[model samples]
Target chain A: MSDKKISTAVIKRLPRYYRYLGELLENDIVRISSNELSQRMGVTASQIRQDLNNFGGFGQQGYGYNVNHLYKEIAKILGLENHYSVIIIGSGNLGQALANYTDFEKRGFVVKGLFDVNPRLVGISVRGMDVQDMDQLKDFVVENNIDIAILTVPKTKAPAIANDLCEWGIRGIWNFAPVDLQISNFDVVVENVHLSESLMTLSYRIKDSY
Target chain B: MSDKKISTAVIKRLPRYYRYLGELLENDIVRISSNELSQRMGVTASQIRQDLNNFGGFGQQGYGYNVNHLYKEIAKILGLENHYSVIIIGSGNLGQALANYTDFEKRGFVVKGLFDVNPRLVGISVRGMDVQDMDQLKDFVVENNIDIAILTVPKTKAPAIANDLCEWGIRGIWNFAPVDLQISNFDVVVENVHLSESLMTLSYRIKDSY
Candidate 1:
């Protein structure tokens, strides 16, 4: 890794680049020029060069970028190489879907447990493990050393549940709740996935086309 | 709407503003200063003013903004007032969750149907409607005049299915597949939700913190 600090925008684009490159590797493409990549990604060739340059410029003069090398580099930078114990709170439709998503396990986000306060949901089997009640949350987090929490609870219950997760020493939060979880007090980071916002964006574009 | 083209960054921020304003309305907070809104949203006061100015500035000097008025304006600008008939093109776990999500319907995105290729899933009920087979996709979309298709299919199927959707007159797509659907040939918009990318971002932040 380079000693220079990278902008948040660059960090955000890294995952996208990683995705595109992974596809390229899957197709047996071992090398790609910046221009070729730009066309596929809908990003400018110069922009791609500039972004990769932040991490020591993976391309040679005319040799272009080595696809597998670049993919591995981004994966390492994104910390996908490490294992993280994850728990899904609010075992609703979305929570159950997350638990069933097999790709996360491949990427090292192991779902240790599913949790909910509802009597109907608790004690139900999810991926071979019983959905635990809220009462068992603290012990589960402590014993399993859960690193992240995927919050899919209702907006009304999101904040309080997030507070509990933080207090129990969860390092990161993948919040799917409608509410934004404020985390200024704890040493934790949150990535809020606002699905409704994205839907609105699509609507905006659709309406614009008219 | 302002005659000048708004930047994509400002367009992205509109949904966040809309959400925050909605929360304010729910709390019975009728009025708020740009500074207060900025503090709650974690955006700078000037930035908020600048973003709003693109839509003819909703603020009144010294008196702040009328929360309800601003919220309504943002909603209208985002095209949330219009009804969009939607179809979930995959009866998988993610697809079913999207079908059950009530917020989209509240905002006028009605799920008219869910589609799948699997025989076992085809006749199953979801939200009072039976999951339709892939054979019905064309007729259902055309007959209902579907405006958007929410794709929750696998990546291998995304591009081809998206192509079919475009051919059948889908105005927009909310894709959950990892693959980016290239739709340059048709006049359609897409919003791809990569859950793994988001999870990777959370992992990146956690790794950075250490």
Candidate 2:
């Protein structure tokens, strides 16, 4: 797979395609034309063809995309086959929620520990995993080979925790904190889920309709 | 504001600029050159200038952009001044998290009701609001002037609930369900937060780093 040459835009769209294909597989749909997929995804058929073409043109000339094959290929491309040790920091509602989300576990992100600075949250069990103290984070991350840390902490605590996570050899940071915590000079990737921003987007879109 | 012609790509970047400018305002910084902001945001200076230019160029000649002015303008453009009544359709961990999340309230998205179909979850308290029955959804949404419905429901239930919410005059959907629910020929806008895809993106970026 000559994936290195693919654009970031294409890479982002791969997951959506992967998801849709997964649904198709579940429904026992063997193949789908780009036009059908385009209508379903609200994207152009040509765009789908072009994106798939970037990865050696997975679509057959007239057959469109093979559901099972494309599903597996996308999963492989997105590194879904590789299992990652995950930890949820900040045992708040959102943290516990992510800890409870079985979808992440199904996609090869295994939650090994949940941590928090608050003593009330520490030692509380969520989804069969006990909430550990922040004190245990460094050792737990290093020893267990934790690959990703989900930051659900408040804005004030996020940056320092992200920095420490990077230093502790955590590879990826999935940030839900309101603030942007970009840690450079380390082999760390930060992906933020800014709920506030998403809400603002909703407001922007529906303001005229209202 | 003649914002009708602005591209969706630029609209997506506005929240980020709004947030960055907000931090600048909080720090007592009244002005910023696009170059200075580009360094912090990892955006090109020219791109920042072009994006803000779409909103009538809030920058000053040789003096750079007025942070407070840009912040206010972005807020207005993103429709942040408007208060929106909201309801959560799933009273599980994710739904409860959104209910407890203070940032949504701060941004004027007030959660008016938390609802679920599960018998055990119904009438439970989450952040002062009682989790209501799914049977109450239609009436509550209609009478409460609810502007948005956050669908944190399971995958099987989200699409049907989204359809009902649209029918009940709910203006927007912040979907966390794995499924894509598109309601056309209606006054509804969907903003999805697919945690699984985000995790996949993180995996793709850090596959070699690990």
TM-score per candidate, in order? Answer: 0.95, 0.94
- Poorly placed runs, candidate 1 (over 4 Å): B1-5, B55-58
- Give the C-alpha lDDT of model 2: 0.88
Instruction: Please give, for residues A1-210, the per-residue lDDT of candidate 2 as tens digits.
Output: 674667888998999998988888889999999999998898999999988886666688788888888888878888899999999999988899899888789889999999998989898999988899988989999999998999999898999999988888888999999887879746899988888888899899998566
Error of 2 at B197 (Å): 0.9
| lDDT tens digits, residue span B57-156, model 2 | 6787788998988888888888888899999988888899889888778878899999999999999999898999988888899999898999988899
Model 1 scores a C-alpha lDDT of: 0.90
Q: Which whole-number lDDT from 0 to 100 does residue A169 have in model 2?
A: 86
lDDT, model 1, position B67:
93
Among the numbered candidates, top TM-score falls to 1
Candidate 2 chain A, run of 10 with poorest lDDT: A1-10
Worst 10 residues of 1 chain B by lDDT: B1-10
